[model samples]
Target: MASVTENKPSNPWQVWRPGIDPAADALERVSVLINRHEHITAGYAFTLGESARRYAEQCSLGFLLGLEMVVREHGNQAAILGWRHAASTVPQPSKSQNEGEKDA
Candidate 1:
């Protein structure tokens, strides 16, 4: 007998910004740093150095993801705040037109 299963739509892991690929850039920079560090530790024989490298990579990944989230949140907040301030200061069109009229 064959069984049927329900499929769910795939969700995006990160919100993308126009003209910027944060994940790709983060991964690329991390790869470069790992390679450079590996080259410098080429003569090391202890697991301590390897462990430290692993920890650093994990920390870098976390930091990059957190930074992206913070930036998105802050950008949204700033836009909303600006809009609120602008709305409050805007004068009604009728009020402006009436201000220049004088009784005949």
Candidate 2:
């Protein structure tokens, strides 16, 4: 049988977001954002800037917005990897595929 493997952290995404560093993730996401749009508009700048500015002010929102932008600009795979990296800073509790499925 092929067992499913899942990564589960004791902390929620919000909790994970705070401890993780945002600079590298932000840069990577912002790079993708900059590449996607040839012409940068004020709104675009605002969205990107706001995401960074508010990250410290509002960790959850900033983290979510950053993830959303990355997913929008890149893809879900990138977002998934990004999330994994973000969560790497924290200690995660491992769960088997079957166990994770049951929880879901």
Candidate 3:
């Protein structure tokens, strides 16, 4: 008997988008963005940009835009999940740094 391994589920944000060719387009757009902005902070900004670009490309613009609206209306939980994945393997700070914030 051959052993089989189960495939793990993809992230909800990733799964939320559908189709193939469109997804590829989105990824390409995202790659262009990343390449353009490589000098920016190597963190969340870059990550989210890529993720959004992918979602936009892979899914219909309406779907991506609707998701944004849903996120805006519903609050940031879903969006945050997507952002977290894009940011990096290591977790980035959840809070924005303020001028008043003292370094630890």
Candidate 4:
């Protein structure tokens, strides 16, 4: 006798958002700093330092993936997507963090 197994769909993995994850926040912060100091626009290549090149590539990957998720979730209308995406999901920072200092 052959046995049959039922198939169940798995939940789709969500792309991590900055406001919802500390790691995501760190990634976003570094990404922003890299862009600002390097004076490169989003999705642009960095032709200077090795660190700059690597960080730029990493930032672009995260940005593209996040944009893809946002587009898929919200369709073409992007006027309010930034606000919606930034809506708080993660808990507020602790007292130490709120005091403008991060624990080492």
In terms of TM-score, which candidate is strongest? 3
Per model, how many backbone clashes are there?
0, 0, 2, 0
Cα misplacement distance, residue 83 of candidate 1 (Å): 33
26, model 4: CA deviation in Å? 0.8
lDDT values, one for every candidate: 0.38, 0.49, 0.48, 0.38
Q: Would you list the rank order by TM-score, best first?
A: 3, 2, 4, 1
Candidate 4 lDDT over residue span 1-100, tens digit each: 5434325444323445434544344344444434454454333212222222232333456664564354334332231232234333324578978677
**Candidate number achieving the greatest lDDT relative to the actual structure:** 2
User: How would you encode candidate 3's per-residue C-alpha lDDT over 1-104 as one tens digit per residue?
Assistant: 54343355556555554454565544443443445444434454445454664555346767667544543343334344554354345344456564336564
Model 4 spans > 4 angstroms off = 1-16, 38-104
Candidate 2 clashing pairs? Answer: none
The reply for model 3, stretches above 4 Å from the true place, is 4-42, 70-104
Extract clashing residue pairs from model 4. none
Model 1 ranges with Cα > 4 A deviation: 1-19, 38-104
lDDT of 2 by residue, 1-104 (tens): 54443344454433445336765445544554556545555455445544433332334666666555664554333334444444444444566866887889
Task: Give the C-alpha miss distance for residue 31 in model 2, angstroms.
Answer: 1.7
Note each model's CA RMSD in angstroms: 18.9, 18.6, 16.8, 15.0
**Per-residue accuracy of model 1 over 24-78 as CA lDDT, tens digit each:** 4443333433445444332231222222223333346676355334333432333
Q: Quote model 2's TM-score.
A: 0.27
Q: Which stretches of candidate 2 lie over 4 Å from their true place?
A: 3-19, 39-41, 53-104
Q: What is the lDDT for 41 in model 2?
A: 56
lDDT (C-alpha) at residue 43 in model 2: 53
